[model samples]
Target: MSRKVILTCALTGAGDTTGKSEHVPVTPEQIAADAIAAARAGASVVHVHVRDVATGQGSRDVELYREVVRLVGASDVDPVINLTAGMGGDLVIDPSDPTAQLPGTDLVSGLERLPHVEQLLPEICTIDCGSLNFGEGSQIYVSTPDMLREGAARIKELGVKPEMEIFDTGQLWFANVMVAEGLIAPPPLYQLCMGIPYGAPASPGLLNAMVHLLPEGAQWTSFAIGRDQLRWVAQSVLLGGHVRVGLEDNLYLRKGVKATNAQLVEEAGKIIDSLGDAVATPDEARDILQLDRKAGAA
Candidate 1:
């Protein structure tokens, strides 16, 4: 367990939740500013996913990614920018006509997902480790083995750290395989995403079990959705893992309350401090994750 805990604040997720809450940053400026605020609040990393400013829907435009990276990187507040490579994988399948694609299936190819990362080689990018049934909708997030291989390969080529987003145990196995295939460079970085429907349950037992199963030399973090977000912060700390917080997996700071990414990160910092541990600074986090090329060579 690293003595220092690195905090990651996921700004705006790729979900269609903009209409749900005004706190969700929809424009590029809003997203980047919110991320900068999170960094100022003690987050060492900012996980980002752009949404269409017009409709507040998910978007994969490279221009948007550039705008976000520019805002965060050029700002006085500097946190490791972790752009999401987990986009364009939404697959809404039809149960009735199993073979026929659903009308809402906006699934995309692996190469199509790389433009953002290719254009803006952020410090880190996320690779969804496997497919899962996400949200209350009839949507099943898709990440096929072939697609995963392609996406992983691209991530490696771009020299970006691939943060493996694992929602289940099977995904961990596949992540291990990716490490073996040299898709992701070692010491693997994992995010055990919990409490979402059709995935692993949010519990200490499950968290411990998943943490136990990480590939050797892998660095991992865990977060539970909704109200359990704060609880999972302490849980991850106790389990010897880092933590991630923000509106991506949650919206409220408390019951019926809207929370900004900075507030969420500030809360996470408090938990880390209470545990007699320091939240890693951006530089310290870069060092810990071996993102500082100099440190890696050393």
Candidate 2:
């Protein structure tokens, strides 16, 4: 019997990859089109992060999220929608004055990051589990314990499944604590984000260790960035987990070759098929994740 794998395409992350890859969608229409195309290409879910059309940087604008969600809902394909609540947590502090925020800072409270999630009520929304020294700079992604507790409670109330974004071992530990406290519902969903700077490296041993730490009956997916993106698909599936791929994680399908969101999804599907595992359909993914579709319907 073939294992069913849920493939998620992260359309446009809150990263600065737009300038590097022409295929990275910046506008709502482009993002939605990519989501529909990815679904057609065998993606079970589309993880979305809206960008500022003018600056090409990530934005927490509810209007942009609304537009993308509306467009995807109106389309023929019905892939599961997973909005990112990972924004509004960037904190770039000044070197000289620790109290002074830098130019790139976009800090806000946890609840402030979920206006779009609250309005659109997507089936799944991301909640970055903890703070991190993001990338190679003074930038830090802040998500305190109090903030996470508040956010998780609200997400539970909204009936939107929170995909806990675990960047490191400590984050995973905290996530398990949340589960122990009954903050996250049964079959808690997790996304093990690897190879992103100071967080957990894209190592197979580490991934396996993290998987072991997940609460029993947890649903999880794993992904890596750059050259490891495609390879991580197989790694994830082989380890009894789902997979994630898209322009947000990696710009190229191969060396010197750029990839579209649909292309990534197609390649991931082929990998799953070759491994004797089938890529789950959107509906199958819903069942696996135990999502309440009607609760998230707009």
Candidate 3:
């Protein structure tokens, strides 16, 4: 296609994948190291989600984010930082007692979710565009319309680009709503997340349909979990969109071979190159996303 594809590496997500793969980064230091490695391996952007060092579970501790950002800042490679502001929205309900929230439920207001974004001021941060059943459980990732409006305003005020995470078509609908209301800036960025749970499935037809729904001239990316991760890199790029990969979405590079974040980035880079396309560099990505170099980058 001869297009410049912006590749992102999601270092570690909040999922329970630590035990499944030893390559998943848990501590801030590990996450930072993996991010740098991914950058070196040709990822223009590094998506971060901090985990508790003691348990390998996801955490929203500002200090953890602070440390990760600091480590990345001190590193030689200066990849565009895209921190996850989608935490504190897990609403795990008790099946037996619907009124009671389970122990893992970390529901908080929209403003409460952006503490790290506000404090750290990364180049990009995500906003879960809507609520949905996250998995095969009673838990829902809460991102109501009211909550989105409030969160969008704060993210705008902080001058951080919001990577609108669209799990389903409905979330894409509300994300357009944010754009219509002038909450989101011009050239809104959307991440079409597929194959998580009871949400959008990872299919080319579905990905194409969602891509059609995006606003004209919108900057968008698409990714699928598990085996679909590497495949979607070609799918998304062929459809004229960006791509994301790494341990957060999938662990194994192939059948029985666990992959690190850098390996995934390298694989994606190869995929882009095989198609006669070039991988976008960090500076090119920053310009494409209109990130403020003075404020967002280190």
The window of 10 residues in a row where model 3 has the poorest summed lDDT is: 289-298
Model 1 residue 49 lDDT? 92
Give per-residue CA lDDT, model 3, range 234-258, as digits (tens).
Answer: 9999999999999999998998999
lDDT of 1 by residue, 239-271 (tens): 889999999989999998889899999999999
Off by over 4 Å in 2: none
User: In model 1, where do residues sit more than 4 Å from their true spots?
Assistant: 292-298
What tens-digit string does per-residue lDDT give for candidate 2 at 199-259? 9999999999999998889999999999999999999999999999998899999999999
TM-scores for all candidates: the values are 0.94, 0.99, 0.98
> What are the lDDT scores of the predictions, listed in order?
0.86, 0.95, 0.93
Best by TM-score: 2
Model 3 residue runs over 4 Å out of place are none
Pitting candidate 2 against candidate 3, the one with the higher TM-score is 2
TM-score, candidate 3, is 0.98
Candidate 2, backbone clash total: 0
Candidate 3: the clashing residue pairs are: none
